[model samples]
Target: MRIIRAAKVLTGRQGEVIVDGEVLVDGSEIVSVGPRGSAGEAAEVVELPGHTVLPGLVDAHVHLGFDAKVDPVTRRSPESERHLLLRMAENARKLVSAGVTTARDLGARGFLDLALRDAIEEGLAVGPHIVAATRPITLTGGHCWYMGGEADDERAIRRVARENLRAGADCLKVMASGGMMTPGAAPSWVAQYTTEQLRAVVEEAEVRGKGVAAHAHAHAAIRSAVEAGVTTIEHCTFFTPSGHRFDAELADVVATSGTYVCPTVHGVMWRAREVYGPEMLDDWLRGIASMREAGLRLIAGTDSGFGAAGVDNPTDGFVASLEVFAQAGYGNAEIIELATVLAADACGVGEVTGTLAAGKWADLIAVAGDPLERLADLRNLALVLVSGRSVTQAGVDTVTASVG
Candidate 1:
């Protein structure tokens, strides 16, 4: 039994906050959470007098196989599977150390993500609880075709989807449009798959009690994904030949469908602004704000390990995403939810974790100060607990303890 007493506890339950609270944890599950003494005595008590404890963060979209510093396509094209898996294990450690308790590997090659997930579970490796999408379904020459998940027809799509599910994939990731990273492939605004094809993938996942995550960067692709009932839309950017085009009507349609959008803005503000230019970046932000106003649910995903500007620092990239939301006019509470409960729900694991509630996993973090008051406090992580096990700054195991 263990108790963590802190100056504030953001329950990750619809912006609820507990002042001077304590969380009782038994084994891997949280037993109770309330005012300081409400949890009573425990075998161990971790006191953080000037800190705040909140749900450990979630990153909805990540590609563990890709190295952020190198060109993903070039880096992985000839790399051995063993080498890629080892690099992925290292990436996972960095992610967990940065306070990301749950991460959904949106895309990966050869089901390496699944192996990494199993490794973490078996104590062979250290990483966040991973929701693996073994390999993303794409067109023969579509985006990320190198991942070896290309299906040219409906039959092939169904076959690949079933194969992935059979291989223990928790979800299915489908390429609905082209991407910026894959050169000579379809452009980002081009629709790679038809509505029927997208629907086929979604149907396969739904019947198997899984969800489909569509990689859509064009307006038409976004519409198709919404119509096909995808759980979340990755990089929901309305790209065009010239630049981006935000469609208000389509945004409203997406909002009505209750589909979550993962803009993957992590590293964008820092690295992409120069690459994408300020004008295009401004347009993207405006579209995001408009979508928020239209009731579209947005979740935080840094696109970590996907290579390029925004991903130089995978650990800090997750927190950088929250800053993007803040700049977009999101309140601190709302931003926190985007990274915690909302993100967990988007990744299909909200029931087990995401909040500081009884019966939930003890996946929370203690920071140097109240993040609710100043978002940057999140960067100053004092301790991170994933399922009641503590992982510190150095990625070393430790018992939960106070931070001065």
Candidate 2:
């Protein structure tokens, strides 16, 4: 048993902050969390007098296979599978060091994300708990066609979905619309799949007890995905032929259906000011604010591998994504919830992790200052505990012990 004592503890529950709190851990599960000195005897106690402890962050959307470079796609045309796996392992570790204890790999090639996930679980590699969507479903020669998942019709979509699920995919990912990464493919405003096709994928995953994540950018694609009942919508940008637009009726429908939206609001979004003018960037921010007004369930997802500024070191980008929510008029506590509890819920891991509660995995982090006041404090990670093991720590001993 061990006690992680901190000056403050944000249990990842909105508005629940315990001052002078202690979290008791027995093996990989949290035993209790309460005011300081309430947690009883333990084999060892790690104390942080000026720190704030919170649940480890969850990045709901990421692409572990793509190297976060200027052109992550074109450069990877000739790499072997072995080399890609090695690179993915390194990226996973980078995510861990940035305090992401749980991350969902939204897309990958050759089911390599599954292989990397299994390797991490077996202790052969170091990384956070991974929820992988192996080989995203796409239209023939559509976006991300190089990843080998391309289907022209519903039957082919079901076949590809079955293949990924059989290979131990935690969820299904469908490219409902085109995206920016692929060149000469359908543009972002183009809807690639029909409502019936997306519904087919959703129904297939539902029978298997898994949810489908739809990569929808076009307004039509977003509406179809909502009507088809996808678990989450990635990059829910209402793209048009000329520029972006926000449809309130569609937003209300999405909000009513209880579909979570991962806006992928990271540092790279600011680059829109250079390409599309400052007014467009301002409109983008306004759209995010409107989603909140419409009661849309928004979760934090950095889309880290897709040219996030400082993607190599993702801590800044992760926090910057949250900062965008702040710009959208969210409070610090609410933004924190988006990255922790809310993110975990959207990814279907709420029961096992997310909050710092008893019977949950002890996935938490301690920072030098209070993130509640200064969100940037998250970058100053003093210790990170993933399932009760100290993966990385500063100013603390190499804590190791057996259950007693």
Candidate 3:
């Protein structure tokens, strides 16, 4: 049993912030969460005077096994897979230090994420719990095809979905349209997935009791995805013929279906544009704001991977997405929800995690100040506890288990 004292507790419920609160964790479950000093006796106790306790962040979209600094895929020569996985494990450690206790990978090559997931689960590594999408299915030569998915027909998609499940994938990812990372491809406009194929992918995953995450940027593909019962849409941008942009019918469909929309917003792209050139980043803000206004269920994702988007760093995206929400006129609570409650819900781990409510897993984070005041305050992270075990704490950023 352990008691974590905090200056305030952000219960992750909208507009709910309690000052001078605390949380008690025993084993892998949260025993109680309430006012600090009020939590009765415990085996161990610590004080975080200036810190705030929050439900550990849930990053809905991430790429664990890829680097985002360069054209990650192009830089990979098939021989560096092992090295890349090791580096990704290090990145996952950084993410855990930043208080991200749970993350869902949007896509990755082979079973790198699966291996990493097992490592973390089996106490062989220190990192966030991962709901990995081993490899996403894509049409031949379509977006992210470099990951080696060459499905162009319903049969192929079904086969790939089953293969991913057999590989212990927690979800199935499908590239339903073109994206910026895949250069020279159709710009988020041309839909690469037919409605029937999309349905097939979702149905197959459903029969196996798995979920589907669609990397859909175009409006047509987004609509097709919503109609087909996709669990989450990666971009959810409405790109039309002739580059006309608007979220169209997909918004209402998602609102009705309760599908999650992961913008995967990271500062790397915009920051890179400032250093590299404003050639891209166009319509990104517009797409995000439009989705927000449409009442779409928005979840946070960093799309951390090798190449054009992420730097393989998960913490960067977690903070960056909060800033994006702030810029879009969202309050602090709503912004937090995009990454926590909503995101965990997106990953199908809502019941087991997300809220600090009792009976849920003891996945929690503590910061030096209220995260709602300064989105960057999350960087003041002090302690991270996942499944009632401490992962990161002030001064000690990384931990290798001690042998008794």
Query: For this target, which candidate reaches the highest TM-score against the unseen true structure?
Result: 1
Model 2 superposed RMSD (Cα): 4.1
* Index of the highest-lDDT prediction: 1
Ten residues in a row with the worst lDDT in model 3?
Answer: 395-404
Tens digits of lDDT, candidate 3, 155-254: 9999888888888989889988887667666667778899899999899889878789998878788888988998998876676655537645657777
Reference-based TM-score, model 1: 0.95
TM-score of each: 0.95, 0.94, 0.91
Per-residue lDDT of model 1, residues 170-272, tens digit only: 9999999999888778999999889999999999999988988999998899999999899999999888998778888999999999999998877557567
Q: TM-score rank, highest first?
A: 1, 2, 3
Candidate 2, after superposition: displacement of residue 142 in Å? 0.3
* Every candidate's lDDT: 0.87, 0.86, 0.78
What is the C-alpha local distance difference test score of candidate 1?
Answer: 0.87
| Candidate number with the higher lDDT (1 or 2) | 1
What is candidate 1's CA lDDT for residue 392? Answer: 61
